[model samples]
Target: MSVNTSNELRLIWVYPDLLSTYGDQGNVIMLARRAQLRGIAAEVVPVRSDEPVPTGGDVYLLGGGEDRPQVLAARRLRADGGLARAAEAGAVLFGVCAGYQLLGEEFAGEEGQPVAGLGLLDIRSERGEQRAVGEVAAQLDPDIAGEMVEGGAPAVRSLTGFENHQGLTRRGPGVRPLARTLTGIGNGDGTDGAYHDHFIGTYLHGPVLARNPALADHLLTLVVGHSLPPVASWADRLHQERLNAVLAGKTRPVCKVQADAEPTGTRRHRHHAPGTCTTSPR
Candidate 1:
């Protein structure tokens, strides 16, 4: 399971055709930049239409989108069953926003709810008519708590990001939350995100990897498994120092919205639970 740092690490980004909303693409670029900085080569593959989905990738990234697009991606994945197979083969998976929603067993849509998802994780997405838009503080699970010395998970640190979505998620029975929120139930009560084995699904925003590099490293570690090189030790120390400063709000980078904004044609639709036909096209 060793990843050749000199060789390009294959990272597959699925459902890009529908979930390319926002700055999701930035996430992959951020990962690539970080990997290069560490002397590791990274390759990003975007999976859109029904082509053969890649397997055994070092990492899989999925982002958010509108409800219809979400459904279409779900259906496509379901038919191909690429995600499940990849999970079985131990590929690292990261799902964000609607991408996170579609990773669950089911997603409740506005019109016909309870749509089947990739089912890689035991979670469900419901209508969150109320948006969780603003800065937030979260608590990471204890297992990886000690690793948050620097640019790690936001745990207890204020995370600034915009959350503009209407669907919330609930981890299924036996599932665990990656963190407890300081504010909105971004997902369901008792749930904000999840990571089982190499799979990481979260309502966390795009550029999320930029904000949480430690988590990114964790996923890369999982994907590379025993193949990773010995930690430079100094690298960790330096990384932590820089990360802590950022989390401490001592190093804030200017944030700007991108220029690729375009209307998807779908207007805001009312919320509805599982079942019923209440959908209107965008």
Candidate 2:
């Protein structure tokens, strides 16, 4: 599909019911809103699991889901074969968590069985003993960030979000990581996401685009086929505030509290000392 000649863009949100458990639908909403903010008309399309995947969308999104649902979705998607065709036709794809795994060669199933994936990305996932859960902060790959931003360089140094997954993803030959983890376990390999051509897959789920508007704008840029002029909004302020809080917490020192002495009266005094908590500088 060529760039929408009438300034409209087609955005396909795939399998919402099966893959939107973690508020991943917000990514689609954010994309559409960002497009509208930039004066580009966006037609958001929801592709249910049972429906045929459209092969003519400018952007396609797949979100996280439970193990069984992910397996089913993957199978259904493979059967349709529209997504693979769309990618080949220059469609930009954004996949998160389970969605990310399904875009790869394969992912571990509920019983540790292998679930075949779309093979759009040269990565694979395996179940880990521990599930990574909590906030995540990472520095975007400089080269990738450069391409995503307006002036050929990223305005922010890092992107922050929450991650909760048991899958350990590793990049295969020729697959470049989207970012390097500064905090939290990502992919169990220090990398946070994977990207190649116009496809991006990640484990982040602050509905990612909501937490990282530059990334959203980047997706818009991909569909619109031109660099977009920066536009300010209240959402940008909120995103920066949340990012600041996360990064601050990541770097903040921990304090240890101890009783100074046994209680001799009605109350006891307490002593506190700063604990040695270190994080990699952004």
Candidate 3:
């Protein structure tokens, strides 16, 4: 049945057992939180390899995983056919790293063997000779930037996160890129991700949405068919801090928070402006 109301939304986390790694499941958690903040009921469903994926969901997410597991996930999802059914009925799909690769027609797998994918997005991945691993910073593609930005928050235009993958994806005619790289190997051609209609794919991993709520809200907006409230000051600040850190060449340690550190709302990086950054003592 078509949704006539946006009062409630279902967020599906596909294949958590075989396709979730690098804290990527956090993306689903953040999505749920964003919806609650907007007073929209959100149900997060974590489907494992052993279960049948529920086809009735507003948004579905697939996260990064190891090669062997990725191959398995692709095989299982293809066989289950739930994801394709959901997408055909207008559900939004988001994939990251390994999940990103498997959304396309095919991807290079263990030992560079070929693995067929779901073909939801007209893209393909071939394992690069050298892995791209580090903090990556990118400016959103203008079209995506305009849709994702809230109230003209410039920081939302810049995306920052950690990427550790070997797949060099190439987009086909059906998909437009999600961002242009400013500091790392993205798509191996300066782009970081691909999106077409309601489907999006990317490689960034700080669970992505945690570091960039604008992107999170953008996904939510698509499902809700409207804009979201302004991001919390702290969320915008975190986005700015991460963007600046990598652009200034700060490594992972600079973005680290202590185990007992103050709440994210209370802490601020010394250099909060773009292009310049410093880690505030925790």
Candidate 4:
């Protein structure tokens, strides 16, 4: 689980061909750029369905895809066993939307039939009648936020993104959510994402990392194996500008769902949940 001897950080972009819906490949680009800007040599390796997943990667990224592709990706991942093995060896993973759903125990397939997942996370996703799609903003779990940024200058509190999904995830016992929903329907359960061990799964798209540079750096820190000194760059400026625009009330096209149809535990405003990094019993 150490960086390659050549001093290059190996990042595996999992199944990009099958899971690049919503411009998720941008996440891999963002991760590499952030590492490069900080003087860390990084190499991105795209793992497609036809290839074996690389176990030497420091970080693995899986993006959203259509239901059929998701089911296929799930089956391929289960058979390859590379992601599971890499995670066992302490590699970090970031799964988004359909990718996020596939990390759990199971998710509804294209026909609403249950499909087996990689089971890297202790959660299950079911297809819901209402799809959650819109501009999403969530308050980061305080403890996770505290650990993400260097110098503790008020860790990035809010995560902004666009969500478009129909899977409603129910967290298993002891699972901690990544954030609390501030604007859109997240997980259809008030929570926005799931975080356990070194794995993070979310429905946020906006190619999430680009809009949340601190998060990108946080993941990079894991790969580089140390606290990285913060650098103010064009990426930071762009992130702030986008955030400011979001806060200023500029919004994107969002799917409409009846208010009464909202999930029971979700709230219209932010709610602080206790943050814990404990993983499911192995």
What TM-score would candidate 1 get against the native?
0.73
**Residue 192 deviation, candidate 1, in Å?**
1.5
lDDT of 1 by residue, 40-138 (tens): 888888988477676656788898888888888888888887777877777778888888888888887658478988888877777765765543335
- Per-residue alpha-carbon lDDT of candidate 3 for residues 1-282, written as tens digits (9 for 90 to 100): 323244578899998898878898789989999889878889898898889988888999999999999999999999999889898988899999998889998898788898999999988888877777778787777788887664333336778878999878878888887877666766766567889889999988637988888888888888877777764646677778878877676553233222232222111212112332344333
Sort by lDDT, best first: what order?
4, 3, 2, 1
In lDDT terms, how accurate is model 1?
0.63
Give the number of colliding residue pairs in candidate 4: 0
User: What is residue 191's positional error in candidate 3, in angstroms?
Assistant: 1.0
lDDT per residue, candidate 4, 20-65, as tens digits? 9978988999999888987888899998898999888988999999
What Cα-based lDDT does every candidate model obtain? Answer: 0.63, 0.78, 0.78, 0.79
Residue lDDT tens for model 2, 123-164: 888887777777777778777788876533238657777888
RMSD of each: 10.7, 10.6, 9.5, 7.8
Q: What TM-score does each of the candidates earn?
A: 0.73, 0.85, 0.85, 0.85
- Model 1 clash pairs? 2-227, 111-278, 111-279, 265-282, 266-282
Q: What local lDDT score does residue 132 receive in model 4, on the 0 to 100 scale? A: 72
